[model samples]
Target chain A: MKFTNFLQISILLLTLTFLNYFIVYQKCPAVTYDDKTVIHQLSKQNVNEKIFFITPTYSRPVQEAELTRLSHTLLLVSNLRWIIVEDSDQKTLLITQFLQRISKMKIFENFEYTHLNVETPKSFKTSRRDPNWLKPRGVWQRNEALRWLRENTTEKGIVYFGDDDNTYDLRLFEEMRNTKKVSVFPVGLVGGLMVEKPLIENGKVIGFNSIWKPKRKFPIDMSGFAINSQLIHDKHDAYFSPYVPRGYQETHLLTQLIHSINELEPKADSCTKILVWHTRTEMPKLKKI
Target chain B: MKFTNFLQISILLLTLTFLNYFIVYQKCPAVTYDDKTVIHQLSKQNVNEKIFFITPTYSRPVQEAELTRLSHTLLLVSNLRWIIVEDSDQKTLLITQFLQRISKMKIFENFEYTHLNVETPKSFKTSRRDPNWLKPRGVWQRNEALRWLRENTTEKGIVYFGDDDNTYDLRLFEEMRNTKKVSVFPVGLVGGLMVEKPLIENGKVIGFNSIWKPKRKFPIDMSGFAINSQLIHDKHDAYFSPYVPRGYQETHLLTQLIHSINELEPKADSCTKILVWHTRTEMPKLKKI
Candidate 1:
């Protein structure tokens, strides 16, 4: 080759070598469902991780729609089953119809509105002065859903009790898939109680930022948690209790399953970006019955 | 006088002097209310101060008996008006009749079930594929109660939103009687987030031990606070908003009222002792239902 041609070829080889090393060194950024392409790319990655989207649904249809949209959107990306328990008066035709749309999803539509009119029991003459009667109902409904899952699901999967009113991000499941035991993440629209997770150090969960009640067994809310199937299968009862205090629903269940926060997986990927937010839709002023 | 008689008199004088100095130097230990006599004795000491027993009731009649008993018991000690707001669906006739028996006590029965269910527009279909018809409902019920009190009540008294499930010691009200602004004390059964209150120094309110969302406008629970009516009257819209995030209920309202934690009065007298706790009663298991 001529001297000019040799110089050009040598420069091209150096550029090619630099590009190869750059590809090897740089890792891919954490996946966020910023758009459909990201989700499609995630789906094509080929991980057969089974995710059990254990959600607790009440009468709110708007929330149910949100969950269904989330599930259907997620089902396209991976092997998933939505173990949705309806905490309703009865399994309504409406909820049944909604669940039919989500493919590869199992609908557990059964609940009783046992704690109707909490005020009636607190009435001086009617209640005979019993203070325990004022507790909100439906804690057992969550337990019932949990029990049903343990008995029915033979496959290994992640379990999460997503309340009906909450706003969820689809990417949350992908992050939780690798959780060995129970994993915790930040929830947005939860006022300023942002980023509740185990204080992890060198891959070990140390403590929690549950400043409101740090002494409680489980300081996080139902939505802020994701437990491994093994944890659920290990426990005999594997259920929540009606006897637990109002906010103790999450705490009581966590105590039975995990030894310490060290057992919990902490995901702060979306911690800066609010993933799941505890947003309750407002009760509209009805124009007269 | 005889030498024996003079010695006895000298000993008696010394004993009286020691007792007088003890009473002046070390204030009497808070008279325990293990029984009714202690309550009666305290009632006589503070007879001139008008007692306002504000009980925030809910639908559970059985749970509210403790609150009703406290209200009734307070009536015996001094003039107390039970500002009982029922967190119910309708005006309960039984609660109305029960309040009638208490003399000089005003029972305000109001119903606002904001937490249990969110109200959506009828046209808001269950599924979003159809159309966007969902509208959030009754987000201002608690704010209405606060506005009603501000607009109506001219009397300067202590205001407390005592939830139905809570256990209250009658002496707690007396402790809060002289509160100029807002006073906070520890509550039992609320140790999950142990000892939430204003940080005080030299009998002045400073800040809070709020580990959660302390930065939120109001970061306190309903049961953990008691404010003078003037604060409510001054901060016109300082009531709660249902539309806000779940835990922001306390913080949101507090931010709108006070400029700083400096305005809050800390009652550390019972800080070591849990007084008004955020205890939610458990759901009872009914085999038949």
Candidate 2:
């Protein structure tokens, strides 16, 4: 009887150990890439710094071309990961296939839409109309890119949301890489008033001169600023909200970030000259495609 | 031969006359409704005195409730038409059906969401998250609503973009109806920015006091003022733009219609105490709806 009891105890212990091993394995997240391979490549020689360029494209081809040109220029400074979020469900072959061929770029395509209904009358069709400012439409896709950076990136680098239609100077990314909280630059063709920017004092941002009414906070544009990955990782709520009034998109997101606008570092000669212009692409009349 | 030619000419003239009559019958635009037939029973005897309440709604149940309450209260006012524009694609059945049940108010529902997507990143999906201050989503929607008024409204009275979330006193409408070019008032919720109104001296509007920054125009909420229909009809571009940074939605739209700050008429005892608070609704989380 003693020998039988000893055998049963041994069996029980073995089963428990097997269960613990299984649980630990389940908790471990799978790595999508070979880390040692990436590490070896990094040690061998220096490639350009990696920049995740997120561009939102709707129905404009010219804007896409302009963005592609911007991407080529960015290639000079860093590895360009152009994640193009198209406003369609099924990826169009034109944009999707074109992006896939580009070296060192990850192309993601998807679509999203939201509408107001509780106050609309029966006779009007309100939900089907495309939103004006493209409120947080591609935000989740941006978060996806952030997730990719967190998981894939070993080297420190910069991330930016480049609107498909805007003009960019090559120097902007170098300026962005130096961001502490968020670096703001002047944007033209916005605010209906004039180019908007932050009033800098002693190499620190005092406040913004935005002509449009944003809620009390860092009232700036999504494109006009850049943030460090460390800041984004540290801050819990760094994403934009759709529910913010039409113009408060940028301000509301930045408000929850680091306290003190003084923490925001100003670049591009204290944001005097325009580094970015908030230009919009007119709807193209597509013919034969 | 001469008789045959004359007969052909006569036949051609007869055909041309009949074609003219048919074209006129088909091409003349249809008047959607004769006011006398549908809501003539609800019309007040007060002919010269009329009030028009215009409101823009995005997506908030509480704001909608406020609008519904306002619609119910407007039952007291004579000859009131509530123009509600939904900033969505298709009209929501819920909102449409609700408007259908309301009496003593002609609910004209329209939708446009053009200004919501300038620099928005493709993958951001920020529109899904709820934020405070549901300001005008589309500059063109207001323009479209005003254009509709120019084409449709034959009534004489006041016009205001009573945003769905604002708190309003019925007495405020009385002060607004007498406005010549524009009227100003104090708005709450803006921290220390206090009230924005035409600075008056000797019964003249000189300039405005907006404590906000960046926007070239005075900082004001959408619910801060009212305008005479004539001014809207007379102005060239009387609408908001996404191009305007955070706080300039009100200022830009107002500046287009009025020349100097002197043109703005002050109400609520020259904006002494806030009559209307720029209150916003809090998002309610439900475990199960």
Candidate 3:
């Protein structure tokens, strides 16, 4: 009876040892990078104000190329939630996989993203023969992002339209984070001018120096400004409309949100700095191989 | 005497308190991001195999745009040291400012880098009159990068030629990191083919599926393969030659380091996956203002 009891205990000990060593070695982690622990270990103690970056991307030759470049710039930003609205009937697998790639990295796991898509109507898309300014691009796509913001988030933060093709200086993000209302800054390489920005006098925006459409109410490029996210919820009807005449998309959206130019907050050292550029990629010509 | 001593003690305590809190707060960190501490805190516990990404970039209409996109892709990858060799007489401020922006980002502060520049002689540069394939691109710039590696790096790692204009999947970086001798993988949209790769016969690479030049021993895109850093040191005299006939750049340098096909290790699941693409950005058209 003593030998029998000893044998039973020995078997149980062996079983536990096997489970602890061999079995655990075979066990795979559900999360490979341990992203949460990494963030907890490395993230800043002070919580940062989140920024919603809205980009309306399309399926052109440079689509993936443009998005890939923009993703790098945004990854540097700590508390940004990217809203990429595709101009297609359904989200392309190409972009879906691209965002997944962005999310899985351990270093920038702190970066947040949202992928949404809304097709641009055929009527709104300009043909090759049409002038570059004939039709406003990314009209409905920007609206989709705003809709996503209203339905999904109640958090108060800044919302900036970050076109994928544009060049952004990291300082621009820092300058806009403390915005209480719409913040305006200069945009480089825009509208047949070296730079375009609102005229600031005594810490107030008096008007814009946009050469193309100087008479428009809010004469600015889509990349020129950022607004408070709460204003989106307050003014539910404001959005970029395709029906608006050429060069009025900025005005059409702004008039609905603010009554006067005094509400505009001048940033980037009172709009003396050009922290972003309204640049576009030249189309590559490829004959079918 | 007692009163004097008490006053002296109070002053000492006040000075210490100010130095610890207010003075420290006002003191700017010489390195604003504390890159070293950030890396020590957030870097992977297991040291990953380092990858030396060598890119040769030149001044073009779309120079910054291409580099910006590529930088984002590299930002996600861990344990990578980018060696950017500019095709210019001196390093430009545009690229210098760009690299500074990358270094200051907290999450990717762990990234290692070296920037060098060597001007491509005017004779080697392509003009509108020349065919795309008439002149070999990035010959001297790549050699400059190789020279930099030999001078600085003694560590064993993987060396790859990452052109600024190509598209890369993050997974490709992982597949090549474990290279013992050399690794070959499929490149998409290369050589006027849907994908280009070395054809495998039974677990070994017997030949390549290159339609452009089937006879060349190592018929591959510049983005197709990576070699061990030790090989670069072992074959110290082996360098890319400008005199090598068109489309023989890969073969010229590869033949010097590797003896036969047996030395090549197939990666990305036996070269079945297309993780990189040889896509080029179309030149953007901007009429002078």
Q: Which candidate is the best by DockQ?
A: 3
- Clashes (N, CA, C under 3 Å) per candidate: 32, 58, 5
lDDT of 1 by residue, A1-289 (tens): 3555545644555555555444422211111222233233344443445666666555631343344334423433345565666655456675665554233121111111111111112222223244523564446456665676677767676777765445455456677777678888876433225444556567656666565567777678778888888778888675666566667777778888887766777775624344565644333222221
Residue pair clashes in candidate 3: A69-B69, A282-B283, A282-B284, A283-B282, A284-B282
* Model 2: docking quality category: incorrect
* Cα lDDT for residue A95, candidate 2: 62
How much does each candidate deviate from the true structure in C-alpha RMSD? 30.4, 30.2, 10.4
Q: Which ten residues in a row have the lowest lDDT in candidate 1 chain A?
A: A108-117
Question: Lowest lDDT 10-mer window, candidate 3 chain B?
Answer: B25-34
Using lDDT as the measure, the top candidate is: 3
Chain A TM-score for each of the predictions: 0.69, 0.66, 0.82
lDDT by residue for model 2 (A1-289), tens: 2555545645555555555455433322111112222212222323244455776564433433344444433333334455566554446676654454333221111111111112112232224365655444555545555555565556554567787555565456566765656678876546653466888888878888765674357777778887666666666456755456666766766776767787787888888866565644333223331
What is candidate 3's CAPRI-style docking category based on DockQ?
incorrect
lDDT of all the models against the reference?
A: 0.52, 0.54, 0.76
Worst 10 residues of 2 chain B by lDDT: B108-117
For all the models shown, what interface RMSD does each have? 36.3, 36.8, 16.2
Candidate 3 local lDDT, residue A216:
88
DockQ of each candidate, alpha-carbon based: 0.01, 0.01, 0.10
TM-score, every prediction: 0.39, 0.38, 0.76
lDDT of 3 by residue, A209-289 (tens): 877878888998898989988899999989888788988998899999998888999998889987787766655444365
Q: Runs in model 1 with CA error above 4 Å?
A: A1-36, A44-46, A60-77, A102-137, A270-273, B1-289
Instruction: Point out the higher-scoring one by lDDT: 2 or 3.
Output: 3
